[model samples]
Target: MVQGHYESLNRKNDERMNAIPYCDTGEVFEADTIANVWKREDKEWLKRTQSDRSGYEYPRLGESPYINMTDDFRMEKKVICQDIFWSCDGTSFVSVHNDFGIRQYLVPEESNTDKLNRNLLLPFTRFFRNQSIVSCAIDPFYTLYNENSDRLAGDRIVVGGKNFPLQLYSLMDGQCILSYDTMNKINGEYETVYSVKIDVESRVYTGSCRNKVAIYDKSRRDAVWMNQSTKKASKGRQSIISCFEEQPMGGQALSRGSLLCGSYANEMFQVDCRHQRLERLNYTRTVAGGIVQILTSDNGRYVYVVRRNSDAISIYDRRNLQHELNVLRLPFRIHHNSAKLKAYIDTAYGLSMGTPQGTILNWGRDLVEFGGVPSHNSVDDPLITSIPPESEWRTNLSSTIPATVVKNCPGDPELFALSHGGTISLCRFGG
Candidate 1:
């Protein structure tokens, strides 16, 4: 593997340590079926892509198509817009624009088909560029519904960066059911809503990059208990590096935290969610780093994160920040593979993805597959990758195909959602 010799904190920084071994779930995910993927890239259409170099190219469609990566994953579709809602029944979908517009469609299933089942939906989208909708939540916000035909979506939503504009949506038609712009009400607090999560009891929890926290109940829809900013104790700037939802969904209580942004020269701290606030927990393999992306398992079994400047992924126990599970490092040689090369690490349990510029090394703990799509800048070949390849246990939620290419499989409720741009993939790991 490319990553090894992690520095030790028990002593001075430069003290190297050996990697510890870990165990896999040993169960394979499966796929009952596959379907075409479609998406709009960065708001624009992209070049066609395929598994085969000479494979057919994909194209853009106006109507809402269920780019099902697999049967279990959420549908993958882009608004060709921002501040929009895209939802589908088994065969068709309705697209709602933020300017109060809507469109319906039955997309063609073949790459060669250009005609869209236009007017499939009524009230076309009145989308306008740069509408001020979201104040915090990341682009491509994750939307959820209680069921397939529920006209109203999002009983609860994780909005804003965390709570700048805590807006709730009525998925039935992308209606703004509620807007709790908490920052305006804060007592002159420096708020950068980093992350927000929902609980079953209809309460909202907002986490800010500045180490501040707020919890609101749906009954009140008001920021009842606001924890003072954590940085109030220090005279320095702190960034809410990253945020995520804690495990065990659907309780009256809410618990979540973030990694403060700064130089990776220090260890990351796990927030206690409430007044215990931010606790310092640095890696003995000291790199002085903060959090990157926070990826949690569906069941919240493991919380995985990639540390800064290092290509390694850290496994944490998530429950109480008890101990570090493993540090997975990809190899340099694998990443150095020739351009136009593709590497995939598909095991019974998981699949590691790489672009043309990167590599996928480390099966158990070392470089196994080499090279990813070369440099995200220099585009040679558009790589289409899928994870937890449609096995019996996980076939529903993973597929990554470029949108321009139209192919078909005989299935419905497509579990896979296309990536929306370079790779029209609607795939992911799901229950």
Candidate 2:
């Protein structure tokens, strides 16, 4: 019976592997180009034959019809753009800078010029009082409603920075609507909030710092709860909460009031915020070096832990969190200090990450393999020793600057990337 089950599973895996398309190397024509090429070819066919009953003539061997299609375009900014986030509707995207400025730009749906030369008009720009924005998140609820409106409404952006309060800005006019202080005493000293994420439905914002995670309720105008990591825990003694080692730099909201966070100590924690007492679940150390960012699949079936200065990403099955399903390694090293990973689950491109060398690496995978954890371990190798296969795409933006963030537009066919030297590039993949 066990042998029969193994055979069935192998067949299923084979079928799934065949279903996933291979990642593009950016050498062929994209979907848009193909469509345009077909249209042009049809017109040429009618002009040549001048009759509907004649067979169409194909292009010459050396000539390809899609040679004139534009697959990528770039835009530049004067000030360094630190981070970027796409609106839920994907019509526009917002970018933050180290100069405490937030600028929003409309995605160029149609551009005749190959290099978008003109500086795009900004809908609005919000400048905070001397506080540099490190990370930003948009309220998903408002993003959907702003898709069709003439004047964008109901959208809010949560911005976090060093020694600054978490502020929510109106997407319509770039006005500060609300602010909450996320500073907390850790071992008798206050620490700054490095990252922030907003739960639109709950109206709660979560901020993470060196050693603690703060949960701020927007309706209360103050922090409702806080969770601190302890050095050691004993049954009879009081555990001392401190931020001596762990530094949580990234987090995401999960179902049922749960939040998944990844820390610099190479630990991933799931905190249950349903009750007053914060319940911790699935606290496990990952093997992808020091984790700087964490992301979940759209379906929440798997969790991706991105490491600092490492090429591999640790993939964990949510159901069985004992071991990682697989550690995906890229061709290049990521930015050690500041880097973000963006996953494209439903698109032709699978995953994308930025590098310190201003390069964007795109990877394709069989997502079905992420469905569940394997029963048997594939290899028992050390974190630094394991190196997976190279990704399908590794395009460099500019060698002079570092890429801070890369994001795939949710409802569009473009991928956006930001550089430390104040440049944003939009890329379209070939089909």
How much does each candidate deviate from the true structure in C-alpha RMSD? 16.1, 14.1
Q: After superposition, how far is residue 38 of candidate 2 from its true place, in Å?
A: 44
The reply for model 2, stretches above 4 Å from the true place, is 1-79, 115-126, 142-153, 181-191, 231-257, 276-289, 338-348, 356-358, 368-391, 394-396, 415-420
In model 1, which regions exceed 4 Å deviation? 1-158, 161-164, 184-190, 228-237, 246-289, 298-301, 319-323, 331-414, 420-424, 427-431
- Compared with the true structure, what per-residue lDDT tens digits does model 2 show for residues 258-315? 6666555555555555654433333444333455566555456676666656666767
For each candidate, what TM-score against the reference?
0.45, 0.63
lDDT of 1 at 410: 14
* Distance from true location, Cα of 261 in model 2, Å: 1.1
Task: Provide the global lDDT of candidate 2 against the true structure.
Answer: 0.48
